[model samples]
Target: MVDDVADSVGSVRPNCSRSWSNSGSFDLRFASDANGKYPSKIDFHQIGAGFGGHFWFAHTRKPGAMGGKMKVTGTWTLDHERTGPMKIMAALPDHGAHTEIANYRVNATRGPGGRVTKQPGDGVRWVSIGTYMFDGVVPKVTLSSETPYGTGENDIAFDAMAFIPIDGQYHEHTVEADALFDENQNIDTAAPESWLNESPLESRERLYNWAMTMSDKILSMKNCDSEVGDCLTPHVGAAVANWRSEVMAAGKDPINHPDGNSISSWIGFANSYKDRPDSYTRPDSFDDDSRFKIRTKATTTFVSDENGKIVPGSQSASYANRTADTHLPHFVLELFRAISEDYKISLPDLGYRAKDLNEHNGEYTSVDPLRSGIIPGRAYSYGGQAPKLTTYTGSGEQRGATCVAVRTVAGGSIGYRTLLSKEGPTTAMSDFSDTLSNSQYVAQSVWELVENIREMFFDSGSFPVVESSLYNVAPPIWQDLNFRACTNETVRKVDGYPILRASWMPDHYLYHNGTAMDQSGALRKTSLPLMRGDFENFSTATIEVAHEYTPYGQCRAYVEDNSFARNKNPWGINPVPRPGFNPSSVQFCSDPDLAPDPEYSSYDVS
Candidate 1:
């Protein structure tokens, strides 16, 4: 923001020592007549440099032709002023600078609004003129314009008093008076070379050039600009050559030598001169060439039989029989431990173990040199069960041991899989039926719990009090966990992925339970211990419901089905029982026929 220090009228306090005046013409005066004699006032003039300031004009008289009238418009600037002895014949310097002014003319006609609208005549015509004036010190300058007959003639004058501040203020000065003219004329011509020819070029150049030269000289005054600390002349080409030679001589092998490789040589040269000329040299050391060598040592270990000979396993002859002894058992145990830790479940281990083999042979007749018999019953048969043992082998025979092993216990273990539906009932179908039944039981238990909570809140004046009384006087422990799980599920679905776990559920549940219990107790003026007990029960029930309902696939399916049911019958009149059975309902049955009436069914007696 530029400051608006000058008033709207453009006035400034004048210095008492300065004398100024303005003639009605385009002339101005500034003088200090030390003689104190009239007409002896030293003068400063305004030379017509060009038109700039505001100006106006009026016609002298109306034209005979209605629209054939000439009007003038102009602007001007003072160029230069002259000052010399007033009437001295001593050939005093011309002592005056040039000034100029400009104006324009156009034909116009009067319009209904008293407007002087320009006619379809010549465009604004410009006229420029210059003048020179002198007094003993500075001269007066003025500008005037004359229009054609019947057109107005106007004159503009600049007040020397107003300009006194500008003259008295600080301004750039030039030694050669001619320099002022060159500036006014907008000339780029350099100062006369004659002055340079008479003096040293070093002293004649501009300050900037002098500073640059000094910087360059200081930079080049030092030595040891090479990597080997070798002294070289202050030139880039020579320094690079010297540094390269030093690096090549440091090694006997051509490929290994720093200068023998283009990249290394370039890097070495750059490092050598990085800060050499301007300051102390600091070069980087080269990398050791041995880093490029490849290792030939083997990283893999192999297992062998008792006879120190390879055994035949599933697909090929084995060099090391990991399954024959310790390897397979160790690896299997490790895998079991890892799975148990991951699933947070424990499993009992089988006593028998086998070794990891580098190769396998499917032929049963192959002898096991280490063991007495042929692989010691490589195929296990229990209760006449067809080979209950699992063979761990890879496709390629000679590629080494199988990275992993498969364990086949006598009876199948608990595992997760998608159950396939069968048209006809079978043993597998029965097992799936059992699983489905269990899932329904769990789902129904959770849904009933939620409905009970909702109903309690609706029926009781105090929602928390009812919730506490129904769910063991514990705080509303499950609200935070359920809300967070719901929110997380939404976020995961929106991000195009499935929600794996509700990591924040436990903490969220605790926080909300505490808050609810505290607020309820405060409102009811109940004992803290009673409130806490109530809260604890409510929280426990809520958490039980949330935990059983909010697993990955379970939560996603529940939300989808609930959302669908809500959207289909937004009025909440849907009387259809949920997919899973509700243990809390009086009619707790698995039959769909005995379920609650459909909320949207038209089979009504009305």
Candidate 2:
């Protein structure tokens, strides 16, 4: 919430300083600027209606077509600004000609008039550029100079742009976030590569603990309910796995790849090199990879005909020709690695990511995925197939907005938030408000994705066999139990396959009536950071055991499981409630009428 006025902010550092000539310019603001135009204690307008100042653009008379005949549009831009197309609003000048300012170039026709915002999280201005979902290179919206009639247009006065949250909550109260951010202002000024000397990648106490938390959620098999805590079901694991693969395939992720640095090998890499341990988590290369770092020009996407969605492939502008790119050769390999372990979640492929397509793309006011026909927003990855998920994004960044006749784009996202610059996983993570928006976006998108996956499996007309754990009979899905069941071998199967439980173990998790997990019960116990017994050999140890155990990292999953589980809930069961193929599907050990098999297998690799 920094005031545009230079003097208003508490302090200006080298990274994020502002120039206040109190005049006008052709300068575009970097919305992703790690150090954005800070606000002052003294609100200029005093009424929260607008941010501190404005950008007044008066170009030296046009030379050609937009030539002297029409007044040229001013250049106020937000580079690396929009993640996906959300509602974009601008502070309209006291004049009438510039009502429509955003890049979309929709007539700026005033709708029943409520709020529109841009410059991501500034303040909801008066008009809009509608809503869109782009996945091209670096997301940007330069409020180009106004040329209403190509002549006789009024001078352009562009004030701050604001990002309207999907919930329409404009005042995010940055004041609170500001103080918290100030506390973390301590920056690490070293080159990113030098951090390797910081040591002990494998035996990191802090990172190991964090890794355990992630592992717990995976094992929890939490339902599709956000009302429940973190949604880390097998479905989520698959989504994460798939997305990680996608980024890597795009050549985006390099360092934290499975083939390279096992996350265990470098979870706390940056923390080790931190100048001040207490500072905000400075990612590997904040200075070099920030979206706001530096870029000479803003990249261009397109101005679609408002009627663009009604036709087949109605990209009336230029893309196939110019091959316009938001990210050349696909992904921006910057921030994808910065927070790989935490935010990016870019681990090596777990070998179980399924693809399903669901779309939620539309106009801001008419975009209702739950209520409208499912259209795919690029982020929704509709047609993106998972088989798909948007588990993380911030408010106003994409999801939060109004919509009109929900238009389903037939493909996947075609936009990337960048310019000539790159983003660190820590880019948006730095600011509290941006972080909040990002998380909200991720939550909504992921929810849509996971739910879509569930529907896809159910609709496929076949039972879903997510993981291989030893639990129940094949058809009855007795195998959704804890991984420990893998040791017995009797009930270890997924849809009749003879594989040990490896990936996607939370096929149909059961939440017993009481007691905390890890404290008791067979299927719901806590997971060990490392495997047990002979598996200990995988760890940094020289143990002499009677039998050599298999390390989890090297565990093998021989067969594919497609078993059915009773998923019947109050919603009525078609595919049966989760984890219930049949009544006789109980593990031989858990079966009341059966006796334990005389033969015992000590280990289950995966």
Backbone collisions counted per model: 63, 83
Candidate 2 lDDT over residue span 25-61, tens digit each: 2333322112433221111121212334233433222
**Compared to the true structure, candidate 2 yields what TM-score?**
0.19
Best by lDDT: 2
**Candidates' TM-scores?**
0.11, 0.19
Query: CA shift at 288, candidate 1, in angstroms?
Result: 8.4
Candidate 1 has its poorest 10 consecutive residues by lDDT at: 174-183
Q: Rate the local accuracy (lDDT) of all candidates.
A: 0.18, 0.23
In model 2, what is the error at residue 560, expressed in angstroms?
Answer: 56
* Residue 158, candidate 2: alpha-carbon lDDT: 47
